[model samples]
Target: MSAVLDVVLSSAFLAAVLRVSTPYLLAAFGGLVAERAGVSNIALEGQMLSAACTGALVAGYSGSVALGALCGVGVATLLGLLLAALRLELGADVIIAGIGLNLLASGGTAYAVFTLLDDKGGTSGLKSGSLPAVPLPGIDSIPLLGDVISGQNMVTWLAFLTAPVIAWLFYRARFGFHLRAVGEMPDAAASVGIPVRRVQYTGLALSGALAGLAGVFLSMGYVSFFVRDMTAGRGFIALAAVFLGGLRPWGVFLAALGFGAAEALAVQLGTLDVPPQLVSTIPYAMTLVALAVYAWRRRRQAGVEVAASV
Candidate 1:
C-alpha cells in the first residue's frame, strides 16, 4: 500500500510539472523567433500582460473563449508592431523600449482592473470561459501514456505541437534560412538585398502572438480570471530558458520541463511539514542553480573549443 501510494503521488506531481511548464514552453518559443531574427524581445512580459487583460475582458463580455484568445493575440500583434516601429524604424534602443513597456504593463493593468472592472487588484470571481480540452486521437486508450498526452487544454497541445514546426521552419525552410542570415550577419544579409527590418518586424509580431497564447492559457486554460501582474516574472524565466536551451526548440522544451518540475516540487513541499518560506523559495532557488549550471557548461565548452583550435 505504501509503494502504490508513492507511485500515485509521483505521477500526480509529474502532471503538475507538465502543466506548469506549458507557459514557459510557449514564451520560450516566442523568444526563439525574435532572437533568431536578431531582435532581443525583452518585451514578452509586457505583451503577455496586455494579452491577459484583453483575454479576460473579452471572455467576460462575449462569453466566448476562442474569440477572447483571438482578441488577445490581436492586441499583442499590435503592440509588437508598435514596438517594431519604435525600435527598428525610429531608432530607439530595443532594451530600453522593452523596459518601458514592462513598466507600463505593470501599472496599466492594475489601473484598468480597478477603474474598468471595479476589481481592486484583479478580475476576481469572474468566469473567463475556458479553452476546450483536446484529446489526441487514439492516444486516450493507451493507458498512462494516453493520460499524459491527451486531455490537455487546446493551447497546451498547440504549444507542444508548434515547437517542432517552428524548429523546422527556422532551420529547414527558405524563409528560415533568411531569418538565420539576418540574425548571424545583418550587413551581409542586407548586401544580398534582404530587408532586415521587415524580417525583424515579422519576428517580433510572431513573438507577440506566441506570448499572447501564453496569456490566454493563463486566463482561460488555467484560471477563470486575470490577476494583477500574474505572470510573476515568467517572461524573464523564459528568456533564461531560451539561452540555456542553446536557442533550440527541443532544448527549450527540456529547460522548461526542468523548471516546471522544480516549481511543482516547491508547491508540493509547501504542503508537507516544512517551512512555508523555504518551500516558497525552492523554485527560484532552482532557477538560480540551473542558470549557474548553464553558465558553467558554456564556459567549459568554450574552453574545449579553444583548446581544439589551438
Candidate 2:
C-alpha cells in the first residue's frame, strides 16, 4: 500500500510541476530570443501584465478566448517594437527602458481595469472569459505518466513543443547564426551584411509575442480575471532562468521545469500544516539555489578550460 501510494503521490507532484512551469517556459523562450540577438529583455513583467489586461478585457467583452489571446500577443508585439525603437534605434539604455515599460504595465493595467471594467484594482468575476484546455487521446490511460502528459492548456503544450524548435533555430539556421553573430560581435555581423537593427527589432518583437501568450495563459487559462501586477515577479524569475540555463534552450527548459516544480510543491505544501509565509517563498528560494549552482559550475568549468589552455 505504501509503495503504490508513493508512486501515485510522485506522479501528482510531477503533474503539478509541469503545470506551474508552463508560464516560465514561455517567458524563458522569449528572453532567450532577445538575449541571443544581444538584447536583455527585462521588460517581460510589463509585457505580460499589459497583455493580461488586453486578453481579459477582450475575452470578457467579445466572448472569444482565442481572440483575447491573439490580442494579448498583438499588444506584446507592439510593446516589443516600441522597446526596440527606443533601445536599438535611439540608443536608449535597455535597463532603463525595461524599468519604464514595467511601470507602464503596472499603471496601465490598473487604469484599464478601473476605466473599462468599472472594478477596483482588477477585473474580478469576469464573465464569458476562459481559455479551454486541450486533451491528449490515449495518453490518459498510461497510469502515472498519463495525467502529467495529457489534457493541458494549449499554451502549456506549445511551450514544450517549441523548445526543440527554438533550439534548432538558434543553433542550426542561417537566421540563428546571424542572431548569434550579432550578439557576439555586432560590428563583425554588420560588416558581413547582416542588418543588426532589423534583426534586433524582429527578435524583440517575437519575444514580446511569446511573452504576451504567457500573459494570456495567466489571465484566461490559469485564471478567469485580470489582477493588478498579477505577474508579480515572474519576469525577474524568468531572467534568472535564462542565466541559470546558460542561454541554452535545453538548459533553460530544464531550469523552467525546476522552478515550476518548486511552485507546485509550494502550492501542495501550503495545504499542509505549514506557515503560509515560508510556503510562499518556496519557488523563489529554489530559483536562488539553482542560480547559485549554475554560477559555481560555470566558474569551475572556466577554470578547467583555462588550465587546459595553459
Candidate 3:
C-alpha cells in the first residue's frame, strides 16, 4: 500500500496520466462537438483506427510526417462527412451507419496492411517516424514541475490546450450558440435561420478532425508505427467521457483526465504485486460506474422536471 502511494504521488505518474489521456481528451471533445450538433458520431472508433493506420503508412512512404498527419486528418474528415451524409441525406440510422463504418475500418485497415506490408500484425516492418516531443527548456529545469510537464509529445500539449479552446468556442463563439441551439431543438433553430444542416455537417467535420488528431497521435506520437485495432476501444471510452462530463468541454476534460489517471494507475500497479488482469480492467470499470451515475442523475432530473410541469 505504501509502495502504491509512492507511485501515485510521484511526478512520473502524473506525466503518464497526461500522456495516456491525450487520445481520450481529443476524442471526447470530438464526441462532445458532434453531440452538441444534434448528431451522435458513432464512427469515432473507425475514425481513430483509420487515421492511425493511414498516418503510419503515409509517413512511412512519403517520409514527411506533416504530410502524413494532414492526410490522416483529411481521411477522418471525409469519414465524418460521410456519416453526416448517411444520417441527413439517406435517412440512415446514425448508430447503424456508424457501426458499419467501424466494421469497415477494422477490416479495411487490416487488409491494407496485409496487402501492403504482407503482415497480419501491423506496420512493425515499416519505419514510420514518431512526432516530435516539445521540450520546455526553462520549465524543464524546474525539479518536480519539469518532471511532470517538460518533455511531453506535441499532441499531449495539444490535448490539454483543446479543453480551453473548446470552452471558448462553446461559450463565446457564435457558431457554438447555433450548435447548442440546433442540438437542443433543430427545427426551432432552423425556423430562426440557423442553417441547421450546414452547422451539423461542420460540427461533424470538426469532430472527425479532432478524433483524427487523436488517432494520428496514437500511431505517430504515442508510438512510431500502427498496430491492428490499436485504438482498443478508446474511442468508445471517450464517448463515455462526453456523457460523463455532461457534454460540456471542461467537464469532458476532467472526465477524460480521470480516465487517463485510472489507466495510468493501472499501469503503475502492474509493477506492484497486483494481478495484471485486474489492473488492466480499472479504466473500463470506472467507465461503467460513471455511466451508471450519469444515467441515475439524468433520470432524477427528468422526474423533477415532470413534477414541476404538473
Question: Model 2 segments beyond 4 Å from truth?
Answer: 1-8, 301-310
Q: Report clash pairs, candidate 3.
A: none
Q: Assess the local accuracy of residue 232 in candidate 2 as a C-alpha lDDT between 0 and 100.
A: 80
Clashing pairs in 2: none
TM-score of every candidate relative to the true structure? 0.92, 0.93, 0.98
**TM-score top scorer:** 3
Give lDDT: candidate 2, residue 6.
51
Top lDDT model: 3
- lDDT (tens digit, per residue) of candidate 1 on 257-280: 777777777776765666888877
Instruction: Go through the candidates in order and give each one's C-alpha lDDT.
Output: 0.82, 0.86, 0.95
Q: Supply the TM-score for candidate 2.
A: 0.93
The window of 10 residues in a row where model 1 has the poorest summed lDDT is 1-10
List clashing residue pairs in candidate 1: none
Tens digits of lDDT, candidate 3, 1-310: 8999999999989999999999999999999999999999999999999999999999999999988899888989999999999999999999999999999999999999999999999998999898999999899999899999999999999999999999999999999999999999999999999999999999999999999999999999998899999999999999999999999899999999999999999999998999999999999999999999999999999999999999
Error of 2 at 187 (Å): 0.8
lDDT of 1 at 247: 84
